[model samples]
Target: MDHAPRAPRRPAAPGSPPGGDERVRGAHPHAEPGAESDPDRAGGFPRPRRLPERQTVRDQVLGALRGALLSGELCPGAVYSAPALAERFGVSATPVREAMQLLAREGAVEAMPNKGFRVAERSSRDMAELAEVRALLEVPVVLRMARTLPAARWEQLRPLADATVAAAAQGDRAVYAESDRAFHRALLELSGNRQLVAVADELHRRAQWPVTEDHGCARPGAAPARGTSARLVTDATQHAALLEALAGGDLAAVESLVRGHVCGT
Candidate 1:
């Protein structure tokens, strides 16, 4: 049978908006069709949409604090007042205080009766303990998933892994931390155990909290190495190696990789 000639493709006019199969920038990949038309469905998986007025303030404040903590801007031993943070973030003190209360509950910060919140300091022992807990919970689950989950699942997760590498290469500590979290969380979620994922996530966050002492050392008040971004680049390599080990069903290698990652040599 004869076929009609396909039309030549043409470039969009400058300043024209995307249409007809061109994805809108930042559109959620997992959103169901027509989700944009429904207010209730505007939010994407893993992140909430613009929240209600009251909740939006809390979210913004909390997010800002979390970023500061992960990026080492809020060092251990620093006492930060809610008003100061509010001024920094251009928000009200109430939301900042509310956010600090949540962080206190998470053990990321401590409430000071008259003074505001102080970043919680972790000892080497504390980090070691956190790593032990993480290993006890996460290692077996990940090994099992490595053996049972179809290879396609690992393939599907490559983008998240790549995101970690990209974030690390950019040397953005907060972005790397978040992308790293998403990579691990996506891996653990494959086990279909919500409670395990939740507990493991908390342990992960606690382990990453700023330490008063150098990692793996007894000395108090030691600083983290200046090569943190370089270390993350190494970590990205390990993440790729881990995927290879998993794809090969090497349980021993998987366990070793998991332990090294959790313990942070």
Candidate 2:
């Protein structure tokens, strides 16, 4: 049978990395057809889209890595090489290495020389300890802020709290984690203590480590188990309740809600 001649390939644009666009578009071999066209459907370490001009490739990879962690795509205690992740993300290894290094510094992963980065594992006790510490630091500060922070300031935080609820409703764990942290960080920032904010942020990141089964096994690429979505929505709803309690000067309600929210009581 006769065949048509193949068209000549166009040269990459000046200053553009070779195969840059194609790599990003072609990375998702398993994605459903037309999934890339809709950002909402591009779950779990999605290909980088056009971001703000200021966002670097490393930043993009870091964000995706965090999302992967939250979604349990990068299971706890598993080692992953930067080059492998680079190919998965359709980016160069340099950005993935830099991003992994940043994650290592953030305590999310540990560098394994001549191997790869291992996702940090947390025991049940470790989670409890983190929760206790968070409660100790955040509950008191939030209570104080409730009394002194202006009503308008509390109102300003409404949008952030709502963002968490929105993310939860969408059943996107990664998005919920980011919005959840944003809500807490914004609330803490009202305390006007940069150091406290920094510490609390780190603790929050640690608290969000992907949970493992009782036998220390991780379910990779699994959907949230039964009741997980409901729990997320319930937890996210508390953000609004917290703001209301704080704004109403209900110290008792604020204490209860903040403790439950922080410690997962």
Candidate 3:
């Protein structure tokens, strides 16, 4: 009796390594142990990974919303519903609402009755006033630190300052804002005043609110328009200069740089 012919083997997927059995096994031969296998990897249609639930989702959504706000993707004075934002983020509405509530507390957005949260619309006067307040609070403290903070301590902050410059060069407003804030916070921490650092950080966040076309402020003696890549790079480079001033104990330069950095002068 003649035996039935053996079935032909399935062909290897395109881009697969020669002699590899990844298509049959549903995973790469060199894949990490315990890594999830993609059933459709050979077809180039890998499934999307689900976000973690609860606090992780809430924190991630909050960070994403904050980035959007800083990058001007979430426009000022516009309302965004929690359900809509949740859909956009591929998360449940519960976490989106929680994140929006936190933003409301931070004064980044305000809740509307029976509606969604509205992005805070801060005027030019508001930004100028916040900047003046920040200058009043920060300049003197930084000047004091300049005289006493050790060079090594100031040197430690160079990375944060460099991060701001890199972010500015890339024109990523969100990353630049965060790096700038981290640099200032690290600088102020040398003053040994936790309360001052906290207050100054809040002021910095408020001052960073995106200004609409009708409410823009031009920096004194700066040729580039506000929020432009040139303006951001100019602002970012000051962090390194300020660190150098602090390290060298140049009180006048420290004071002037701090004031100009905060007040946009």
Candidate 4:
């Protein structure tokens, strides 16, 4: 299906931006500095409540849980209870249960008959399917962007590219994952397809969830390779090269690199 034309995406000029949802949770295992937590206060990586009206307890619980999943605080096999998560976040079990159900719907968590919930486990086939979907959705959009989007727009993504490199160098999985996500998102947003962005984000998140076992990248697991820190450094370099290809309007190179990145990463 063909779409109407719109302005190409303009990446941030230089400085770093928030690492998507990671920034929302503050991404640290501990609470933010000076942030207070009480059993009744309801906190744990939740976004700040606005003054006039605070976020609903359910939203707060959801945000914190999502952050936990992304930050590796919640592992694939870890089983957790609503009451326990509620106590830890200082929220009510009602909200925690509601949030867990939501995550379950997204396949981020699973419900046990007696146990509350466990992080969802992915098989090698599961990860492969996610990568295949991501490639189908993202590669074409990026190819179009490369051919039509102005070169200046691509230059704005330099900071995100740099952040990916730094995060890989530092071996910070959370940072690397989020930075890589951000870079791809920035590219897709240029295509002005909201549905595409939403679907791509879902696949990206699933692909990123860490597996408890050591699974080869080519097999079915998609969390960066087992010794992925070094691999991430190599991948980060490839991101820089991809940006150069996009800027140069090399359609063939853009498509080739995007395929390798979406499928192989």
Candidate 5:
């Protein structure tokens, strides 16, 4: 009998978005088919979708502050004036401070000694290092999933992959990031190892910002320039092939494809 690999342990009930719970650019909300929901545009080009309206001052304050950080509007090492942001948001310093605290938790900003908070800065070296880690950890985890999981798990993840592809085509990095994450975690479930999954979770979350999620752009001569377009085509193609390999139980191919696809070498 071909023994199916059982999940090593119970997996976390897939629930809610990772890290910051609310929707924002580059922040994936509950995984759905609409991360790149704009009506007009080709794939790999993300339409500029408006952020959600905040139902509370706290949400608004956090939303604005987070936006400023991610868009490169706020430079690293620049001390943020909470009072000013509070004023700008038309709220009190309390909410702004709360928002800052939240950003610090996400590693998007660092708390300074006398300067309140500054946007987190990663050097090119840091980026490369993180990318290496992502290549190392995620590719293997995904390959294992491709090699192991049962049909039901693949069924659960297909919509996510499809959604991510759409999100990438539309250039909605946040939604694309989230759906991409969902697909990975769903794949990780095949390992049945909770600890690996948790580590994989944080690893993917950290790399979310700098990824080349431009599936619509990762073509041989058509990849998008800068980070505006996600470099998704290569990864997407590799992933799609891996999925097909999984369906067919091609372990050697999963191993080889994932490494070259993610490492680019």
Candidate 6:
């Protein structure tokens, strides 16, 4: 769905207008019976308050926990204990449990048979599968965006790409992950379908294990031959090629390059 447009800003009434001092019936009631009162309303400004029907506390907790998992702050082989999370997030255990259950449904965390939720583990095979899935979904999106999106928006990606390169140069894995995520998001946004963009986002989130593994890109269980991303010049070259394809609007080459780059990486 298209985003709702923001309401037009009301013209400022000459300056700092206060509340509740409108000239009701053309008489200055606040002034002593007959004196000219300040036209600006005073005494009735609305106070800010929480809405009863806004997102539940559990939802907020769930979002925070998911963000933590995605950012690699909460490593695999760790437990997401409700009481502990509650203490961390300044909420009650009830909301924490609800949030953990939500994360479990999304496969970000797993409920242990005997206890709390554990950070879900992804093996080398899982990484390979995720890379394949990402390639399938993202490559075409970039191709399409390159073909149809405004040149202005396409140009906007250069800074994001530069940031990614800088992060890589400095070995700032965290910044690198974010800039990489932003660059792809901009590409996917050009698809002009919120639903499709959301689908790609979910895929990106799931593929994070393989793409930017915090515990180390390839561990004991991972292998280079399983179609998982390579960690050398191949990765850099593929990304450069992907960027070039986008720059050139090579729609036909988009899918294959994306697949090759991701799988190559």
| Most accurate candidate by lDDT | 2
Question: Model 5 TM-score?
Answer: 0.59
Q: Which portions of model 5 miss their true places by more than 4 Å? A: 1-68, 88-91, 211-226, 233-237, 260-265
- What is candidate 3's lDDT per residue for 1-265, written digit by digit as tens? 9999998867777877676455545665555544454463433445676877665889999999988787666777888899989988999999999999998988899999889999898878888999889988888777777777688998998889989988898776778888889988888888889999999998888788777654333333333232567888999999899888888888888888989889888
Would you list the clashing residue pairs of candidate 3? none
Candidate 3 Cα misplacement greater than 4 A, ranges = 1-55, 214-227
Q: Give the per-residue lDDT digits (tens) of candidate 6, residues 165-215.
A: 655554433444555667667667777788878777676666654333435
Clashing pairs in 4: 124-220
Clashes per prediction?
Answer: 0, 0, 0, 1, 14, 4
* TM-score per candidate, chains pooled: 0.74, 0.74, 0.73, 0.68, 0.59, 0.58
Overall lDDT per candidate, in order of appearance: 0.80, 0.83, 0.81, 0.77, 0.63, 0.64
Residue-wise lDDT of candidate 1 within 1-103, one digit each (tens)?
9999998766665544555355566567677777776666654544356856555789878887887776566777778898988888898899999999999
Candidate 2: tens digits of C-alpha lDDT, residues 173-227: 7788888999998899899999999999999988887556532233755653222
In model 5, where is the ten-residue run with the lowest total lDDT? 211-220
lDDT of 2 at 146: 83
Best by TM-score: 2
For residues 1-265, what per-residue lDDT tens digits would candidate 5 score against the true structure? Answer: 8999985754433563554344444535443455456464324356677899748777777766644443344556567778867766788888888888887887877787756787666665555676688678766676666655675666656776676677667554554556677777777767888888888777666655442222122222332322344465445555566677777778787777766654544
Answer with 1 or 6, whichever has the higher TM-score: 1
Give model 4's clash tally.
1
Worst 10 residues of 4 by lDDT: 215-224
Which of the two candidates, 2 or 5, achieves a greater lDDT against the reference?
2
Structure candidate 6, residue pairs in collision: 18-41, 19-41, 229-265, 230-265
Worst 10 residues of 1 by lDDT: 215-224
- Model 2: CA > 4 A from native: 1-53, 214-227
